[model samples]
Target: MKKSLLIIALAISIISCNKETQTTEAAAFKTAYIDTSKLMEEYTEAKDVAAKYKSKSDEAARKLEVQEANFKSDANYFQKNAQANGQAWAQQKGAELQQRQQQLQYAAQTMAQQLQEGHAVEMDTLVKSVKKFIKDYGKEKGYDYVYGTGDAASVLYAKDSYDITDEVVKLLNDKYTTSAKKEETTETKKEEKK
Candidate 1:
């Protein structure tokens, strides 16, 4: 009777232990990480944003360059004719050139600041979009945690198998392409209507 009771108790404990193990396994958290630098580099939307800003910067630079060239030409003309134009005229013209220079400088500074602010706003929007996308992806994929690794890496090390950067980038690009196509189609339809 004693041996049988001992056997029954052992069996009960074994069953309980097995049940606990199974529960623990089932409750294990699923985690993954992304290489943000790679994601940004590969993401089509990010690249497009960068290209758009670059184009804007280039255009602004070209405008400034033209203005600068004109200013230089005017200054050269003034210098060449300063003495021949007489002291009073030279001083007046010199003041005018100085005013022009100040205006040019102000314009350049304003343009640069506007571009910088616009770029910053766009980048902030892009980052927020990406973060929200990642959050939604994590929930959809049953990921308990999705860490980021980049210039300001939150994750120090993760196995390559656990990296989802490529997957995220691919999905983001596909979404962007689909949206872009839809926009183009909508525009084309509007144009046709016209």
Candidate 2:
């Protein structure tokens, strides 16, 4: 009876110890968070993409300005000559001006739509790229969870030690620079071959 009781006690202690170790392991699971706003601001690829779109937007704006000037010129000409041209001629010129105005409006709308769509697509790609990099970084570093905190930070507070924003930004920028270099090299090689 005594031997059986001792064995049961020993088994119980071992089971308890195992459970305690499991809890400790669970507590040790690594987690970190990144400042997403900082990441976006510092990420080279994101800046490059923004600059690219800004140039496109600027070009569109210039085209619209030119169109606007032309439309204004046409309107001024019609205003000056409408009285001398007679009702029939003035009506035809007014109709032509109206059509040109509509065409300019349509062109402006189309450019705006294209710019919006391009921005959406570029932003989407940038978001995906950032997410993928973070995911891979977390996995590589054995992180159980890598949280993101930004303007609308879900994480109220976190230890500075847990913030990996700088590391992530550096990694992303280095990758961008390396890829850009490779592209330039390829272009040079192609030019040499030509």
Candidate 3:
């Protein structure tokens, strides 16, 4: 009888220990997604500026294309009329045309380089801001691991329910809003003091 009781006690102890461990693990861990795309879209000023620069560059390219077409038409007209007028005048005009083309090319190249440089600067600044936010978020929230989709090897196929993108955005908006309110109050106090 005592032997049977001992076996049952040992089994209960093992089962209870396992249950405790499982409970502790369950309480300690959770999986979630940050949906970085949403955050970048929402808070990224650099991305916005880069987009503007790209639009401007595209516009400049289109304008240059129109100018090139006009130049081609003018060149054709000049070539057709060159036989009637002195080749000297046409030659002079051709040299002038070449100068104009060189100037346009230089301008286009400069604008393109400007766009590229601006985009690089904006992206670098954005990356720094995002990294700082993520680092602070991890520290503030006690996240064991905060992974981004940029890591293609992992973090694939997370369900929408597990995503905390909206939550994080909302939290940030609230924090900023509250800070703005506090600043406004401080400004009002200063005005009163004055």
Candidate 4:
């Protein structure tokens, strides 16, 4: 009877110890908050990318306007020259203009596609760079979890000390700078080759 009681007591003690350890572990777990809005606002690469695409789109619009004017002028010219070829001449000029317009439309569509594709590439690259930085940052800091405060999700309550936003922002900026330098170097080399 005494031995059985002792065994039961020991088991209870062990269970109690385990519970305490788990509670301590849970309490010690750290949560870090990252402000993605601030990072995005300060991000240079994103701005640069936007500017590039905006300029390209503007150029496309100007080219389209010029093309429209040329088309109108060509149509007028064809109308004036229709008397020379008699009946079929009008149809021939219209057909030629139609073919040329179709070709221009195809080219414009292709340019728009390329612009979209370029934007996608830039976004993917930027996102990948951020994820990579996060991975490295987490590893280096021994972070239990880093909570991203994207625009949709509000961080209602986070301790100022636990905010890793600045650290992450720095890492993102550094990565962007490195990649930009590499791209510039590559462009310079290509230009030299040309």
lDDT of 2 by residue, 88-177 (tens): 999999999999999999998999899899988998998998899899999999999998899868898999999999999999999999
lDDT of model 1, residue 180: 99
TM-score of 4: 0.71
What are the C-alpha RMSDs, in order, of all predicted structures? 4.6, 3.8, 6.3, 4.8
Q: What is the lDDT of residue 36 in candidate 3?
A: 72
Give per-residue lDDT, candidate 1, residue 25. Answer: 83
Tens digit of per-residue lDDT, candidate 4, span 87-112:
78788888999998897898789989
**Global CA lDDT of candidate 1, please?**
0.94
Tens-digit per-residue lDDT, 1-194, candidate 3? 99999999999999999999999988787566676766666653545566788798889899989988888888888889887888898899889888888987897899788888878887887678667777788777877666666334358777777677777677666665686789999999999999
Candidate 3 has its poorest 10 consecutive residues by lDDT at 145-154
Stretches of candidate 2 off by over 4 Å are 1-23
Off by over 4 Å in 1: 1-27
- Ten contiguous residues with the weakest lDDT in model 2: 147-156
Each model's TM-score?
0.87, 0.87, 0.62, 0.71
